[model samples]
Target: MDGQHYMERYIQEVVRRLPKGQRVEIALELQEMIQEMLSADGEEVTVESVLLKLGPPKELAKKYRDDRRYLVSPEYFDNYLWVLRIVLLCVGLSVIFSAVVNFFLDPKQAKEAAMELLYLPSGLLAAFGAVTLLFVILERLHVKFEPSQSSPWNPSQLPPLLQKKAVISRSDTVVGLVFIVLFCMLLTFAPQVFSLYLFSDSKELTMIPVFDMEHWNVILPLILASMMIGLVDEVVKLVTGRYCGAVLAVNAVTNLCQVMLSFVVLKMIPFWNPEFFSWLRKKCDIPDLLPYITEEAFSNLFLGLIVFGTALELGTTAYKSLRYGKN
Candidate 1:
């Protein structure tokens, strides 16, 4: 190959593995170095001989990438792994739950259940990719990972040595915030996606909306408020690293509002799709399923479960606040 062609090819190979922003600059630097090396010989040096002295493209790329090729840098690697594991766990659980639900809803759709399982690996990969991408962005932005940079360290703000149980974990708060954000997005943009669907044909599926959309005018605002409050509370917990009296109070108020809203929404509207049971009966020819699958029964059961869960969460929060308030 001609000297210029050889140099261009060699440079292209080395730069291809580097970050886009640094590729041009690195290439120029490498070209300059090669020219200097050639001129120092006091004779015309062929690109082949210059490259022979410089070594292989892979080794050159490696030298350029030293300490810089990591998707998540050392400062954030632990956090990145932690987030990835949690996200993958959540994704796995979600996939399993969805598969189980689908199986129960339509036992004939065995392929659908299997497909959900098949999706688990892809879901985990996607979660891993997303977490890695986020950490990469943060790494590039030079986010400070040091405790001093994160928040003011106050020895007085620390909980008592005996009250180690009072401390809130930042990781837990972040994971909760992530779940809340995902739920909020689902509720706001794709509420129907949560609904049960029946496969009418190989290529056709019929959806049954889970919630009464007519009551959405009243429900959406309440849901949005509750989710926003939850998100804010989690963010505060993440930032503060410990729950103070003020944080506990805010959390209590938000939980109360959420519980109250849940009750009101359940009372004022039937959440289970009105047509769901009827459609199931007509299409599946399963009369025996009627007694157990009544819409009212399902709605009441769902509401009761929500109330119980909310009340349990509230009680736990209150207990924690009281038990550790002095700390």
Candidate 2:
């Protein structure tokens, strides 16, 4: 096999697996390696020659795959990051999918299902957050990450709550309860007057079937259940907040449980075109109107949350900034 054929086969395999940037670099490097080997004036560097030198394709692929950050790292990542990766993957996929769905769905379907279906992500956050809690517990039980063995990222720097400090305060518990109740009220009643304004011009509401009474029975319970969940979340946030210790992880769990519950209600209820829900619950899914919520709203809400978490974490940067830096 000529040197050209030798390089072609190796290059093809490398190109197929690598991202374009890395592939270019690796290709250049391999070309250099091939040229150097060919000119060495020892064994003739043919396709067979290079093939014998570079080792098997499988071995090369594994080396390349291991060369960078792994898709799932059982080594060095420690269980916390490992769990985080899974959660992040799930939430990212769901967010993307929901965004796509909302983009195309009729605006009417989006509104009816959007706010109430936050339960999906809430559930995912809960499940993964629990895994994180377990990892924390293991650390408390003296789990060690050995250099020789692959372990989750060391969680020693994690907060006292996450790192086994009894930092959960009575004040946090009370405040969480208060907000949960407040949220319940807001979600359930939602100032129907306000909603009426928001929906006044919506085509879906406007195009309501002339004989719409039948679907009301199916949809109304979903609306009601959502109100109840705000309360549940408040209580959960209070409890999870104190226990999990990692503020973000706790919020994610609290949110995830709601998301799961949202899915259950959306799946079980009749409000979203009873016929469609009926058909989908059996054959597919009555997914929430994920795409309906404006990305702007998501961003704003996420920002607010980050601000709130930071307030708790940093003891109110705004207050400090104002007191020390401002008048």
Q: Write the per-residue lDDT of candidate 1 for residues 1-327, one digit (tens) a residue.
A: 357766776786566556556788999999999899889876866667778777766557778665475666543455556556666776677677667766765679878776768777886787677667766766686643212224432222223433456667766776786697567545654466677676765846667877777677778777777776675566445433445565676677877777677766666665556776666667665667667677666767777897788778767767766787454
Best by TM-score: 1
Q: What is the TM-score of each candidate against the true structure?
A: 0.47, 0.29
Native-to-model Cα distance after best TM-score fit, residue 269 in candidate 1, in Å: 2.8
- What C-alpha root-mean-square deviation, in Å, does candidate 2 show against the real structure? 22.4
Point to the candidate with the largest lDDT.
Answer: 1
TM-score of 1: 0.47
Please list the residue runs of candidate 2 whose C-alpha ends up more than 4 Å from where it truly belongs after superposition.
Answer: 18-21, 42-44, 64-117, 123-327
The 0-to-1 C-alpha lDDT of every candidate, in the order given, reads 0.65, 0.43
